[model samples]
Target: MRFATYRHDGSTRAGVVDGDVVHALPAGTTVLDLVRAGLPAAVEAGTAALAEPEVPLADVTLLPPLQAPTVRDFVAFEEHVEGVRKAIDGVAGVPPEWYQAPTFYFTNPYALVGAHDDVAVPPNSQRFDFELEVAVVVGRDGASLSPEQAREHVFGYTVLNDWSARDLQAREMRVSLGPAKGKDSATTLGPWLVTADELEPYRDDEGFLALDMRVSVNGTEVGQDLLSNMGWPFEELISYASRGTEVRAGDVLGSGTSGNGGCLAELWGTRGEAAPPPLQPGDVVEMTVEGIGTIRNRVVAGVDLPPVAPARARPRTRKRPAAS
Candidate 1:
């Protein structure tokens, strides 16, 4: 079952996406709340609640399908590294230990947006790009979990548009603070969240590893890469991420930009060069990870723009040094 958070009638409600239409769910429908209530049982309840007919997806806007109690992203692909190696300082294909451990970040939870919405370009960005990849939504709360038990904690999965502001990202990294301005503004998620049970037919040692996730600007296919191509596997990411930390139900763990070709920065090279494709106001970006779903967002001219300063993560999980 596909789930979503949405807005309609001047109010926000959550719903299950059925086919192309979304059946309105009750308000206060957060993935975390549902997970803590009892994952599989909660999903059963969300499904049962959808029995009462509601508005069609066409009639309402899909907000970020999740209100992740915690939003953490990890660098888990080798393709992305190999692609940007030459451009970045001393960086090249899967730096030795990078694949051995899952690298993660704690991003702003409030700024996340929904699919098909307009992505606001912040005042700080001159170079904006899109990253198409799959992300997992945790279903059960646990810590120190084994790889064998990890699958039980995943409620579903979805596609993500890990938009980037290249210039700001580069600057921040020099200060040993990763993606200060580089990852701000809008992180688009959703269209629908595909449940774990639904994907039983595709499970393997690499799991979703080999599935092709594609992206497009306006209407052309950029390139397609297989999830199996990842340098780090999902199981490794989940198991390692849970160490000494509480990964709650509804927390989203993003598989950082799939491969170098997954985003414009890698595909087009930085500004002083020819852009394979540069995004501007009015351009539409769409990302689709097979079995997960698609995320479509349009670029729009930003307003007066906020300060662009990064927000402090709540409760502040342990902070890792940026230089490592």
Candidate 2:
């Protein structure tokens, strides 16, 4: 079943999505509440909501399915890493450690926007881009879970757009510390969340979801890739994430950017002069993952803040006394 958080008549509420109609869940209930309730309960509640009055999907404004407790984005696609590494680090191949285990980084949860929200080009950024990804929401809490055990913790999936400011990212990563401020602007999630069970038919024998993913800008197609191409499946990513750490309900795990032109950065690495231009104000970005849904966001101009004070000059070293 598909679950969504939407605003209708000036009030925001959770609902069960059925084609173009949405059936409201009880008031005050959010998608996060349903995720924390566990799958069976969530399903039961959704089933009950289906009997209530229907609201046209177009009449309500969609919101991010849930406000995640934490967001961990993984580089699960080898092709993405290959292309991006070349462009960002001037490297040629995927790092060996990336194959040793699934690697991820934490992004700000407060920076999230709804599927159709407006995203501003982060202040001081000129090269803005969007990453096409699929994200899974955790249904329960677990720590140090094995791959087999992690499967049970998945609640659902949704489309994610990890918006980026390449210029900012490049400068910060020079210090080997962050993609911070670079990615601190906006991360889009939703349209709605599709429950895990509903996607059983799409899962392959090896546990990878054979989903088609695509991204377009201003109605022009930018890239497309298959979810099955991921170097590490969602289960493994989740398992690796739980290594000595807890993954709680509503925590989201993203399947990085897909390869075969997932984002402009990767395209620039592979296509150089032919790569499309970076996102600009008024540009619309739309991303879709086969079993989940699509998320569309528009870019807007950002207000620049005053420049921060530069770092202090290094202190002069004192001359030391000669040792005996």
Candidate 3:
């Protein structure tokens, strides 16, 4: 079943999405509430909601399916890693340690926006880009879980756009530290969330989902790939994420960017100067994952801030200490 959080009649409500319509859940309920209540509960609520009044999907405003407690994005596509690395650092291949385990970085959950929202280009950024990927929402709390155990914690999936400021990212990563400000600006999630059970037909025997993934800019196709192409399956990424830590209900895990031309940086790496230019104001980006749904967002100019002050160097306070 597909679940969505939407606004109607000056109020936001959670609901089960039926074709062209949405069945509202009880008042004040949100998708996050359903996720925390567990999938069986969500199924039961959705079943009961089928009798409630149906609202036209087009009449309501969609919101992010849920406000995640935390967001962890992983680079699980080898082609994406290779292409982006080459563009950013002129590196020709993936780092050796990248294969040892699934790796991820924390992104700001508060930065999340809903499907069809407007995203502002980060201030001072000239090279804006979008990453096409799929994300999983954690439904059960677990720590130190093995791949087999992690499967039970899966809740559902959604399309994710990890918007980027390539120029800013390039500068920060040069110091070997961040994709911070470059990424923290905004992340797009939703249209709606599709339950894990709903995607059973797409799952392969090896636990990978053979779902088609695609992205476009301003109605022009930019890239496409299969979810099955991921170097590490979602289960393994979840298992690795739970290592010595905890993954709880409402936490979101992203599958990084898809392969092929997932982002302009990848195209830039392979096509050099001929690659499409970075996103600009008024550009629209759309990302879709089979079995989930599509999320479309438009770029807008950002609020420009005064120039940032450079860090001041501190005086050397420590003497030679008697040449010890």
Candidate 4:
């Protein structure tokens, strides 16, 4: 069953797609809430009429599939990693240790935009690019899980656009030791969340989700890749992420960029360097991951960004851990 977090008549709700109709839920109106509620048949018991596809699909704003207690985006695609290392620094291939370990970075939860939402180009950023990726949403909670035990933690899957501002990102990382502003702004997710049962067949088929990915901006095809190219599979990332810290059911894990040089930093070189037509103010970016759906948004001026707030620090838990 295809499920979506959508809005109807100004009220946001969880919905299921039945043919061309969008069946909107009443009270427990969200993807996270639906998972928490065990997808009871009782809740899907209403709908006097099926909503028109075009009206609801574009009208109902999308939300990140999971409320996500935490979001750790991992860079496991070798081509992407290699391109990133070599692009500015001229270094090819990741360190052996990088392959041995799963690297990830935390991102702001509030900077999320649903499918069809307008994407703002940050001011002074000439390198505005998109990464087409598949993300895994955690279901059951646990820590120190074995690889064999990792599958149970996954709730579902969705697409992720790790939108990047290359200039600010590159500057901060040199001092901060990793990606900061290069990735801090808005992350786009969804068309809808596809359940684990529906996605299981794709795992380990060559690698990761075996779907073809194609992206276009303002009618121009720029990026395309296969989901099977991931360096680390979802199960491995899940097990590794839960090694010590608890990973909750609603938390989301992103499989960074889908291909080699998929984003501008890797594709067209950075600003002042004259890249191939950087995303102008009025271009429309559209991405589609097979079996999921497509998300299209117009690029607006960075001045349109909603107000920025002070960053929140993740504080240590009040209680310390016990000896294992």
Q: Please identify model 4 stretches exceeding 4 Å from their true place.
A: 37-59, 88-90, 204-207, 269-274, 304-324
> Per-residue lDDT of 104-217 in model 2, one digit per residue for the tens?
889999998999999999988888989999999999999999988999999999999999898888888899998898887899999899999988899888879999999999
What is the clash count of model 4?
Answer: 2
Off by over 4 Å in 1: 90-92, 269-272, 304-324
Checking candidate 4 for backbone clashes, the offending pairs are: 139-249, 169-182
Candidate 1 lDDT by residue in tens digits, 138-165: 8878898877677777777888788877
In model 1, what lDDT does residue 73 have?
A: 80
By lDDT, the better pick of 1 and 4 is 1
TM-scores for all predictions? 0.87, 0.96, 0.96, 0.83
Model 1, clash count? 6
Question: Which run of 10 residues does model 4 get worst, by summed lDDT?
Answer: 40-49
Ten contiguous residues minimizing lDDT sum, candidate 3: 315-324
lDDT for every model?
Answer: 0.74, 0.91, 0.92, 0.72
Model 4 scores a C-alpha lDDT of 0.72
Alpha carbon lDDT at 241, candidate 1:
82
Clashes per prediction? 6, 0, 0, 2
lDDT of 4 at 15: 71
Candidate 2, position 21, lDDT: 99
lDDT of 4 at 124: 66
